[model samples]
Target: MTSEAEGRFHIVDVSSITSGSQRATLRTDDGVRIEAVYEPYTRGVTDTAVVLAHGFTGSADRPSVRRAAKALAEHAAVVTFSFRGHGRSGGRSTVGDREVLDLAAAVRWARERGHARVVTVGFSMGGSIVLRHAALERDTGGHTDAVAAISAPARWYYRGTPSMRRVHWVITHPMGRLVGRYGLGTRIDNRDWDPVPLSPVEAVPMIAPTPLLIVHGDRDPYFPVDHPRMLAAAGECELWLERGMGHAENAVGEELLGRLGDWLTRR
Candidate 1:
């Protein structure tokens, strides 16, 4: 499945790379096409694979997502994918709800490639999706070894920070959705989360027995330290609050990402 528009080429097939990595077009059960890239371990073939989920309005090719994927690839096989509505993928973003299906598809792809251990690592909106996905227990392999969420919100509809308020505005206003669709490459749903999806705090407890690492920054404006604290308490998991970290993928530098990769490998 290949297509071209205005001289640019698009390969929509599940293509294999010479280096053992696989780049594929994965379709979710809900009928969304996801752009996914899998990079096998550069060091050695390890049983563990880290599945990375990006933040809101972000694609797998974003510099921060790529940096984290590259860093984690040193420790284990890495799978990174763009959530629907974010990149070349189809469908509108249900914010964090339907995105879980996207993560589930990526996890299935990792398992299909024979990775025995799948560790999900997510940032911001991705972080919330990972939590809910783990709770839903929909991994194609029947189990996920570990989960790591960075700068995730515990509850929803929080507007304490200016950034979050702006985000809310972007999600609510028609002009904002227009800008999101064109400028950010994000096709977002304008409706509220009807029937209400499980909150991250509510989802955390169900991820127990499966190791969880909740990482946040004390200075994060998007979500205060209390968010991580609430998550830690619910899941009874380990928490790491960085001193001056800002938020999500951009705030997580190489050193911290290396440590996170190390943590995933150790488990």
Candidate 2:
């Protein structure tokens, strides 16, 4: 990659393929270098851009994320990026806390790239980030035209499920952090969330007037149907309880992706 300084952010150009796809390094306002890929629409012409955020341990290059990006790109331009500490990105993961800045950087980049409308679609940890970012950064340049969160938790520190319990251990224990780093290729932050950031349930209420969609699987192993129900109750939005779906990107099928693309296009 060739790096070039651009004001407060840095960009490392990887490749610009003929398919209108390109890869680059994006520097968040917090100074974290994020690895990102942009894929232009393949099926039709559109002014919308979808900024796709992956779940924990996922990066832009991950197969599931790539599949979703390719599917969404059929409707509009797509931008997929690694949260800090994942893939080729620099810095440690804050889980979902400071990751807002990372999403903000991506949204800003999307606007600068000439997309008239920008939508944020996130899964799992990313789902919460998109919820919080849409609410907290509404006045900021990071504001998105619409938002969609798949398989997100409604509240914070939920340990009702076994998966969440293990997640907590990974975030709170040193050994688990090591496992996250080496075993999962994810580097987690050692510290806890001080003062606690705004939770997704609270953020949902603030996203009114801006279109919001909450998608959750009825068979989600991480969080039950109550999660999406809580979010929908808090916000005036659409809720889709995906039958038989599991969790996050892994469970997303082409049909669901196509429906999500159609929804974003309408907004």
Over 1-267, each residue of candidate 1 has an lDDT whose tens digit, in order, gives: 343231111223343332555567787878788888888798876888899999999998888887888889989999899998888788889889989888988887788778988999999999998999888874345346889999999999999999999899889999999989988889998778888999999999898788899999888989999999999999668899999999999999889998999998897
Cα lDDT of candidate 2 equals: 0.91
CA lDDT, every prediction? Answer: 0.85, 0.91
- Which one is best on lDDT? 2
Q: What TM-score do all the candidates reach, one by one?
A: 0.92, 0.95
lDDT of 2 by residue, 58-146 (tens): 99889999899989988999999999999989899999999999999888888877898999999999999999999998888889999
For model 1, what is the error of residue 209's alpha carbon versus the real structure, in angstroms, after optimal superposition? 0.3
What C-alpha root-mean-square deviation, in Å, does candidate 2 show against the real structure? 1.8
